[model samples]
Structure formats: C-alpha cells, structure tokens
Target: MYICLEGIDGSGKTTQIKLLESWIQKCGIDVLRVFEPTDNEVGKLIRKLLQNPDAINENFQITLALLFAADRTVLMRDITEAEALAKIVISDRSFYSSMVYQNDSEWIAEINKHAKQPDLVILLDINPETAVSRCDGMDSFEEQNFLASTAKKYLELADHQNFMVVNANNGINKVHDDIKRIVAHKLGMCI
Candidate 1:
C-alpha cells in the first residue's frame, strides 16, 4: 500500500506522517518512509529555487514543474520496489504537489506520468491563514494568499476515488484519530 499525505504547508503532514508510521509499525506492518522534494540533487535545486520567490517567475514555473517530475521519476522506483516487497510505503508529498503548485495541470500530469500513483491520498485540509500561522511563513510557499489558492486546488483534487480529506483545524490528536480511522477503514487494517 502506497499512502501519501498531502496539503498546504503547516497542515501537519510531517507530524501526522511520523505518527502514522509509528502506529503502523506497532501494528506489525513494515513501512518504507519517503518524502518528495527529497534530498536528491534535483530536489536540492528545487528547494534552493523556492527560497527565493524572485526565482519563481511565470516562465520558471515550468522549469520547477519539470524538476519535480524528474525528482519523482527517481522516487517512483523506490516506491514500486518497496510496495512489491509488501511494505507499506508512506510519502509526505508526491507529484500531486506539482499538480497543485504549478501553473499548468495538464502539462504537470504529463511530465509526471512516470511517477507512481498513491493507492491512498489523505489531504490534511486546513484554513490558509491557520496554516501559514502554523509555519511562520517559512518560505515563499507559506504565504497565506498563495496557500488559500493552493488549498482550494487541493480540495478540488480531493474529489477522487483514492482521496480522503481530513479537516486539520482540530487539535493534532483529533486530526490524527481521523486519519487513523480513515486509513483503517479504507485499507481494512485492524490497527
């Protein structure tokens, strides 16, 4: 099972992924943990570009989109191999981020066609203001207005068979319970 947690920054995906991985392990499931914008060379370049908002002009968006795709192309191999070993692969972000953050959705999808699709996508939905406040506007991506638009796009993308939406305004424990319930039910895990 490949499970991905998606949402705007400060939506607690990092926190929840850690908790979920710990719990799943307690349930005797071997989990392979990974995250996008990985520490690879391409991912490092993406991180570098993102820190300078000036570098993210309209034309550069396409370059960022391609970078994300190239990064995921490498990640998909590990995800596929781990899943084949009966490991539950959990990822913090995926090509889905590119779909939402980048300008051209169709082109983003095409570029990421080689990426592995998640069997389940749990979106940690949160108010844009609340999300930005949580992260302290750490990067260009953490701006409230930008996150608002991105949140809307995420919700729109959530209308899918494999998608699960979790309201993230609640306290961390409550949000985690909801994720656990959703995952347990969807995957038929007794954990």
Candidate 2:
C-alpha cells in the first residue's frame, strides 16, 4: 500500500505521519516512511531553493515542479523496492502537492505523468489563517494568498474515494484518531 499525506505548511502532516508510523508498526506491518523532496542530490537542490528566498522568483514554481518530479522519479524506484519487500510505503508528499502548488498548466501534469498515485491521499484541511498562525516561519509558498490558492486547488483536485480531507483545526489526538480511522479502513487493518 502506498499512502500519502499532504497539506500546506503547519497543517500537522509531519506529526500525523509519525503517529501513523507507530500505529502501523504496532499492527505488525512493516512501514517504509519516505519524504519528498527526498534526501537525494536533486532533493538537496530543492531544499536549498526552498530556504533561499532570493533563489526563487516568478519562474520558481516551474523549476520547483520539475525538480519535484525528478525527485519523485527517484523515489519511485525506492517505493518499488519497498513494496517488493512487502512494506507499506507512506510518503509525506507526492505529485498532488505539485498540482496544488504549481501553476495550473498542462506541463505540471506532464511532468508528473509517470509518477505513481497513492492508494490513499490524506489532505489535512485548515484555513490559511490558522495554518499561518501555527507555523513559526513562512516559506515562499506559505504566504496567506498563496496558501489560500493552494488550498483551493487541493479541494478542486480532490477525489472523494481516493482522498480524505481531515479537519486539521482539531486537537492533535482527535486529528490523529480521524486519520487512523481512515487509514485503517482503507488498509483493512484493525485500529
């Protein structure tokens, strides 16, 4: 099973991933936790670009999207290996993030055409204001208007059967419980 968790900054995706990892382990399942941009060479470039505001400009979205696609291609190989090992792969982000963050262009879709889709995509839904308040530092894409737009795009691309939008405003435990329920149902594991 390939499970993905996505949300804007401060939406608690990292926290939930950790909790889910523990829960899945307790269920006697081997879980492979992967994150994008991965720790590879291309991923390193993406991380640097993210931290250096001056390195990004109007065309940054296009560049970043392509980099993300490259990183995902590398990640796909790892995912296949983990799956062959019978481990459930859980990713922090995936192509859905590109669809939400990048410009609405066919190029974005083309870049990610070869990427594998997640069996389940859990989108942690939170208002931009709330998300901004929860975050300590803002990235280029984490600004109010940008996050608002990203959130809108996520909703627009959401598929009811494959996607679940969990209210991130809820307390951590409550949010985790909600995610756990969804993951359990999808994976056919008892929670």
Candidate 3:
C-alpha cells in the first residue's frame, strides 16, 4: 500500500506520520517511510530555492513544479523496490502537493503524470490561520494567504474514498483516532 499524508505547513504531518508508523509497526506491518523533495541534490536545490525570499514569485512556482517532478521521478525507483519487498510505503508528500502549491494545476498534473499515485492520501485539514501559527514563518510558503489557497486546493483534491480528509483542528489524539479509524476501515486492520 502506498499512503501519503498531505496538509499545509504545520498541519502535523510529521507528528502523525511518526505515530502512524509506530502504530502500523505494532500491527505487524513493515513500513517504508519516504519524503518528497528527498535528500538528493535536486531536492537540496529545491529546498534552497524555497528558503530564498526572492524566489517567492510566480516564476518560482514554475521552477518548483519542475524541480518537484524531477525529484519524484528520482524517488520512484525506491518506492517500486520497497513495494516489491512487501513493505507498505508511506510518504510525507506527493505529486498532489504540486497541484496544491503551484498556480497552474493542469501543468502541475502534466509534469507529475509519470509519478506514481498514492493508494491512499490522508489530508489533515485545518484552518489556514491555525496552520500558519504552528509554523516558524521562515519559509516562503508559510504565510496565511498562500496557506489558505493551498488548503482549499487540497480539499478540492480530496475524494473521501482514496483521498480521505480528517479534521486537524481537533487535538492531536482525537485527530489521530479519526485517522486510525479510517486506516482500519480501508486496510481491514484492527486499531
């Protein structure tokens, strides 16, 4: 199973992923944890661009879209291998993020067409204000307006079947409990 956690910045993806990993491990499922904009050179370049305030323009979005596609292409082999080894691969982000973060959705989809789709995308939905408050406000994308736009895009992508939405406005444990129930239902595993 390929599953990914999606949300705006500071939506608790890191926290929830850690919890999910431990819980799934206790459930006897070996997991392969992968993160987007991986630690490769290309990903490093992308990170540098994101941190540069000058790169927060329209042109930057296009550049980031391309970089993200390249990064995902490079990561695909690892994902394939992990699945072959019967490990359930979980990712911090995926091609879906490009669609949310970039301006031209159609172009983002085209660039990411070669990327593998997640079997499940769990969106941790939260208000833009709440999300920005949790972030350090250092990155180019941590502003409330940008986050609100991205959050809306994420909700539009959520289909409630494979793309499940969980309210992240609640406390961590409550949100996690909701996610656990969703996972149990989808994977037929006991929580």
Candidate 4:
C-alpha cells in the first residue's frame, strides 16, 4: 500500500505521519517512510533552490516542477523495491503536491505522467491563517497569499474516493484519530 500525507506547511503532516508509523508497526506491518525532496542529487538541488529562492528567476517554478518530477521518479524506483518486499510505503508528499504548487501547465502534467499514484491521499485541511500561525519561519511557498492559493488548489484537486480531507484545526489527538479511522477503513483493518 502506498499512502501519502499532504498539506501546506504547519498542517501537522510530519507529526501525524510519525504517529501513523508507530501504529502501523504495532500492527506488525513493515512501513517505509519517505519524504519528497529526498537526499538524492536532484532532491538536493530542489532543497537548495527552496532555501535560496532569491537566487533563481521566475523560470524557477518550471525548473522546480521538473525537479520534483525527477525526484518522484527516483522515489518510485525505491517504492517499487519496497513494495516487492511487501512493505507499506508512506510518503510525506507526492505528485499531488506538484499539481497544487506548480504552474497549471500541460508540461507539469506530462512530466508527472510516470510518477506513481498513492493508494490513499490524506489531506490535512486547515485555514491558511491558522496554518501560518502554527509555524515560525516561512519558506518560499509558506507565505500567506501563496498558502491560501495552494490550499484552494488542493481543495480543487481533492476527490471523495481517493482523497481524504481531515480537518486539522482540531487538537492533535482528534485529528490523528480521524486520520486513523480513514486509513483503517482503507486498509480494511479493525482499529
């Protein structure tokens, strides 16, 4: 099973993933946890660009989108091997993020054509204002306007069957319980 947790910055995806990993392990399932912008060569370049966004021009969006697709390709190779070993792969982000963050162009779609889709996409939904207040420093895409736009885009892409939107404004335990319920249902497990 390939599960993806996605949300804007400060939406508590990492925290929730950690909790989910522990629970999955308790169920005797081997879980492989991975995050985008991995430590590989292309991922390193993407991280560098993100940290130093000012060094790049407007063209960086296209470059970053392609880089993300490249990174996903690398990740999929590993995911395939893990799946062959019967491991459940959980990713922090996936191509859905690119669809939300990158330019709405055919090039972006074409580049991600070969990327693997998650069996379940859990979207931690939170208002941009609340999400912004939860974090300290801001990244290139963490600004108020950008996050609001991204959140809107994510909502647009969210589907009922494959996409599970959980309200993250609740307390951590409540939010985690909601996610657990959804994931359990998807996996046909009694939690």
Candidate 5:
C-alpha cells in the first residue's frame, strides 16, 4: 500500500510520520519511509533554492513545480520497482503538494498523469493561521499566503473524492490516534 501524509509545514507531518511508520512496523508490516526534495544532486539544488526565498526571482513558481514533480517522479519509479515485501510505503510528501504550491486548478484534473496515486492520502488539515503560529516565527511557503491558498486547494481536492482528512490542530498523540484509525479502516487491519 502506498500511503502519503501531506500538510503545510509545522503541521507535525514529520513527527507523526515517524510514529505512524513505527506503529505499522510493529504490526509485522514492512514500511518504507520516504521524503521528497531529496538529498540527490538535483533535489539538493532545489532545496537550497526553495529555502533561500530571496534568491528566487525568475519563474519561481514554475521552478518549484517542476522540481517537485521531478522528485516525485524519481520516488514513484523507485517505489513501484521495489519488491512487494515492503507491505506499505509511507511518504512524508507527495505529488499533491506540488499542486498546492503551483496553485493550479488544472492540477486536479491532470494529477494522475504525473505519478501513481496513493492507496490512501492522509491530509493533516490545519487552518492557515494555526499553521503559521506553529512555525514559531520562521517564514516559509507554509507561513504566508501560500499556506492559506494551499489549504483551500487541499479542501477543494478532497471534495472531489474521498480521502482521509485528519485534524492536526490537536496534540500529537491525538493526531496519531486519528491516523491509526484511518489507516486501520482503510487497510482493514486489526485495531
């Protein structure tokens, strides 16, 4: 199963992912934990550019969209080719995030063209205001208008089809429990 966890920065996706992976492993499932904007050469440059917001001047939006797409493509290919022994692949971020960053409505229509869809897309839903304060003053794509826009986009995307939307405003353990419920329901695992 391909399971993806997505949300704005400071939404606790990174923390919860570790917990989720551990829980799944304890159930005797082999889990693959993968994250994007990888440490690969090309992805490294993209990460540097994205972090230095001031350095972006030309085609900034397109640059990030393409960079994320490339990273997802690499990830998708690798995961698909892996042996089935890895029962579940949990990704911290996935192609849906690119759609949010690009803020393109066409993304929803063309989403499947880029990469394989996940069996379950777990959205850690948090309002943009809460998301910003969670960052503790550091500014990034997740703190500004981008967060608002993306959160809206995510809602719109979710409305089109059924996906798990877990409220991330609560404490970490609560959020983890919610995710466990969702995953158990989806996979029909003993809870």
Candidate 6:
C-alpha cells in the first residue's frame, strides 16, 4: 500500500506523518516512510534547483514540471518496486505536489498516466493564511498568495475516492487522529 501526505508547507504534514508512522507500527504493520526530492544524486540536484529561486527564472513552468517528473522517476525506480521490504510505503510528497505547483490540469493528467498513484492521498487542507502562519521555514513559495493558488489547484484536480481533504488548521494531534481514521477505513487496519 502506498499512502501519501500532501499540503502547503506549514500544514503540519510531517508531524502527522510521524504520528501515523508510530501508530501504524503499534498496529504491527511494517511501514517505510519516504519523502520526495530524495537525497540520492539526481534527487539532490533537483532539490537544490527547486530551492534556489534563481533557478526558476528561466521558463519557470516548464522547468518546474520537468524537474519534478525527473525526481519522481528516480524515486519510482529506486524505491517503489517489489524489492521494498515494507508492505506499506508512505510518502511525504508525491505527484500531487507537482500538479499543485504547476496548476495545469492537462499536464497533471498526462503525468498521472506515468506516475504511480497512491492508494490513499491525504491532503491536509488549510487556508493560505493559516498555512503561512503554521509554516516554520519560510521560502518564497510560502507566501500567502502562492500557497493559496497552489492549494486551489490541488483541490480542483483531485478525485474524491483517491483524495481526502483534512482540516489541518486543527491541532496536530487532531489532524493526526483524523488521518488515522481515514487510513483505517481505506486499509482496513485496526487503530
């Protein structure tokens, strides 16, 4: 099973993921927790390029889309295959981040054809203002307007069955419990 957690930076996704990982382990399931923009060679370059504002200057949209796609390719090839020891793989960010950042439905759809879809995608839905306030490491992308637009794009293109919007504005434990409930129903695991 592949479970992904996504949201704007400050939405407490990492906290929830950590909590969920602990909870799942307590349930006696082996889980592998992973994050995108992995630390591998190609992934390292991609992460550097994305974090550097100047790198986004030339052909912004195209650059962003291609970099994300490349990162996903590396991840899929290296980690998501049958050799994985854990029965469940949980990712902090997946293709949904690319779709939200690019804001192009057609592009996202095309990419989805090649990308592996998560069995469950938890979108920690938080308004931009709240999102910014909660975020710790402020980058250019953390600006309120940028976050709001990205989040709106995520909501617009997501399907109900595969995607869920959780109220992340609530405290971390509340959000974690909500996510646990969702995973329990989808994976039929004891909580």
Residue-by-residue lDDT tens digits, candidate 3, 97-177: 887777777888888888999988999999987887777843455467778888887888886335899999888999889
The runs of at least 3 residues in candidate 4 whose Cα sits more than 4 Å from the true structure, single-residue gaps closed, are: 55-57, 139-142
TM-score of each: 0.93, 0.92, 0.92, 0.93, 0.87, 0.86
Q: Stretches of candidate 5 above 4 Å error? A: 54-58, 105-114, 139-142
- After superposition, the stretches of candidate 6 with alpha carbons farther than 4 Å from their true spots are 55-58, 82-86, 108-112, 137-142, 159-162
The deviation in Å at residue 115 for candidate 2 is: 0.9
Cα lDDT for residue 175, model 4?
A: 92
Off by over 4 Å in 1: 138-142, 160-162
Local accuracy of candidate 2 as per-residue lDDT tens digits, 4-78: 999987889899999999989999999999999999999999999988766447688778888999999999999
For lDDT, candidate 3 versus 4, the one ahead is 4
Task: List runs of model 2 lying over 4 Å from the truth.
Answer: 54-56, 139-142, 159-161
RMSD of each: 2.0, 2.2, 2.2, 2.2, 2.7, 2.6
Task: Determine the C-alpha RMSD for candidate 1 after optimal superposition of all C-alphas.
Answer: 2.0
Give lDDT for model 1: 0.87
Query: Going through the candidates in order, what is the number of backbone clashes in each?
Result: 0, 0, 0, 0, 0, 0
User: What is the C-alpha lDDT profile of model 4 across 71-133, one tens digit per residue?
Assistant: 999999999999999998998989888888777757777999998889999999999888888
Residue-wise C-alpha lDDT for candidate 6, range 1-191, written one tens digit per residue: 88899988788878888998899888888887888767777678777777776754647667767767777877775456632665677889898787777656577668656678888899888888887766666545537778888778777756644588899889888898899999999887666
Q: What overall lDDT goes with each candidate model? A: 0.87, 0.87, 0.85, 0.88, 0.79, 0.78
Worst 10 residues of 4 by lDDT: 52-61
How many residue pairs clash in model 6? 0
- Backbone clashes in model 1, listed as residue pairs: none
Better of 5 and 6 by TM-score: 5
